[model samples]
Every structure is written in structure tokens, then in C-alpha cells.
Target: MISHSRRHCVVELQALPARIGQIRRIVSAQLRHWQLDPLIDRAALGVTELLSNVHRHAQPDKTCTVEIEFRLGRLTVSVIDSDPRLPVLREAAMDALETCGRGLALVEALSEAWGARHQTGGPGKVVWFSLTAAPAPVAAPRPVRISSKPVREPARTALVAVDPGAVSAGMSVAASVGARPG
Candidate 1:
């Protein structure tokens, strides 16, 4: 069976500085729950970059959403912004030391996988990334042994009969366990 853990937070703030604390709290908890802190740092950085980009680009009163989903072995964190403009991959020189061009580039380097796509239900698009964490090992189920001696074949594979009355009833073979009172 697949078990998924998930969380979502909405941010509708104007200033970038105001939302950092909230983002940190939510993202840190998710990272810990997923057991991916080492990789989570990169994810956090990516989230920060994405959130900052939203704040810089999206209009005021625009709402942004952050979501984290944890599967058995992988974790994904997505930031959905109101802006329909998807993030563009830019080719910048590594040593250029550019002030503004390094945000998304840095995100790309840190995350295992990161990209943007249009949101399915709404007009705006979602910019998101996925990170895989070490999966918890599943213990194998123990096998059961059945006796080799053949007994009376059961009428049904697995069945339990109950008469809806005040009666003592039992099934027996060579020994009389209890007689059903009808």
C-alpha cells in the first residue's frame, strides 16, 4: 500500500521579508517529517528562491501556495504563484558574480530535480521541484506453515456461521464439543 503525507500553506503577503519565517517553519517541519534535512537544505533554498521570485514578480495581493507531498520513498515541494509566467532557465557564466541572475540557477544546482509547469485547475501556473529521500525499509512478512496430514475438506475456504438466536452451538468430529440448540 502506498502512504502519502502532505501539507499546504498559503502566502498572501506583500514583502518578501515577512513571509520567510512562515516558510521556514512549514518547510522545516516537512523536511523533518520526510527525513530529508540534508537534502532539505537544498529544497529549502530552492523554495526560498522560488518564493522570493514570486514576491518580486507577482502583483500585490497575489496569493502563493506551497505544498509538500511525501510518498514512501520520495518527497515533492511545490510553490504555486498567481503569476502565469513560468520560470525561465537562464545560462549565466559561473564566475560572472551577477547579482540578480543567480537565484533560479542556484536552485537548479541544489535540487535533485526542479522545473515549472501550468497549474491544472486554475489560470496561473505552478513552479515546483521534487526531492527523493532515503526510503524506510519495509520488513518482510513471516510465512506460515500448514500441517501435511489431510483433514476433512472445508466446505468453504474461510467461513464462520452464526445463528441469530440464544443458542449454544459448535462443530465437532470424533469428540462432542457442544451441541447446537435449535
Candidate 2:
């Protein structure tokens, strides 16, 4: 089996008011690249709410980081901050709407999965989420069809069978091809 990993960013959040647009742009770019724009809009909204809660409820000035891991079949976004308290999940009826208490609840409903974890060797928590299996790639642009002629298929692509109960995708791909890039 094989694993893919990527490190994203570390940013200061002393100016959260100015960071909304920046956050939105980064998330949009990543989602569009991953072909997950359908949920990008929703994720963006939820992420914004999450960040908003961090900014408002946490200390007055702090450094926060947004880390995203994007791979062939999964994406995870984590916001690390210097706060020890894990986020709370409460019924909306208990809290007034103006205090931004609904952010976590909204995220719960929108995300595939999310949670807060205490950072190792540190004094804070990392609020993170997991997004799975981006959408299929978009077909390249082409000229308009002028006739009903048959289309030519692309070259060098292979059809690999997939088993319903395969334990690992990487193993399956390697078994099918016999070998792969190191």
C-alpha cells in the first residue's frame, strides 16, 4: 500500500476580520483542483463559520494555522489554534443566534466528518475535517461538433478491474499493474 501527503500553510490570525476573503480563495482553489466544487461552496461556508468561531471566542490575539491534506481520494482540513477547549455541540434552541453558537452545529450537518484534537507537544487543539473522493476530472475544451461522426478514444489508458472487497486501493492498483512508480 502507498500513502500520499502534502503540507499546506501556517498563518497568523490576529487579523481574522481581514482573513475571510483569503481563506475562501484558498479553499476554493483547492476544491476546484480536486474537482469537489459541488461541495466546495458548502465546505467554504462551513469553514468560514468555523474560523469565525475561533476568532470570536478564542483569545484576543493569536496565531492560527490552516493545514489541508489533499490526495487522490481524500481531503482533510485542519485549523490549529492556541486554545485548549474543544468546541461544543449544543442544540440551537439553547443559544441565541447572534452569538455565532450555531457554527459547530452547522459544520456537523455539512461536513463528511470533523473533530477537535489536542496538539502533541503543545498547548492547543486542531479542529479538523475529512472530505473524501473528489469529483471526476472535467473533460478538456474542444471545438463544437459539426457532424455526427464517431469520436476517437484517447490512447494509452487501461481498464483495471476492481474487487468489491479489496482491502486497499493502492494494493489493488499495484496487483493489477504488477509494478508502479517508486
In model 2, where do residues sit more than 4 Å from their true spots? 1-12, 93-99, 134-144, 147-182
Residue pairs clashing, model 1: none
My TM-score estimates for the predictions, one after another, are 0.62, 0.64
For 1-182, candidate 1 gives per-residue lDDT tens digits of 11234543344444366776667666786677756666667767777878777777775444777776666665677777667778787786245866775777887787678888988887677887777776556789888887697687768754434443423334342133242435
Off by over 4 Å in 1: 1-15, 93-95, 136-182
Model 2 TM-score is 0.64
Q: Look at candidate 2 and give me any clashing residue pairs.
A: none
Clashes of each: 0, 0
lDDT (C-alpha) at residue 120 in model 1:
88
Predicted candidate 2 versus true structure: per-residue lDDT over 101-166, tens digit per residue: 777877777778989889888988888877675557789998897778688877876776555344
**Residue-level error in angstroms, candidate 1, position 4:** 10
Superposed on all Cα atoms, the candidates' RMSDs to the truth, in angstroms, are: 16.7, 26.4
Q: How close is candidate 1 to the true structure, as a TM-score?
A: 0.62
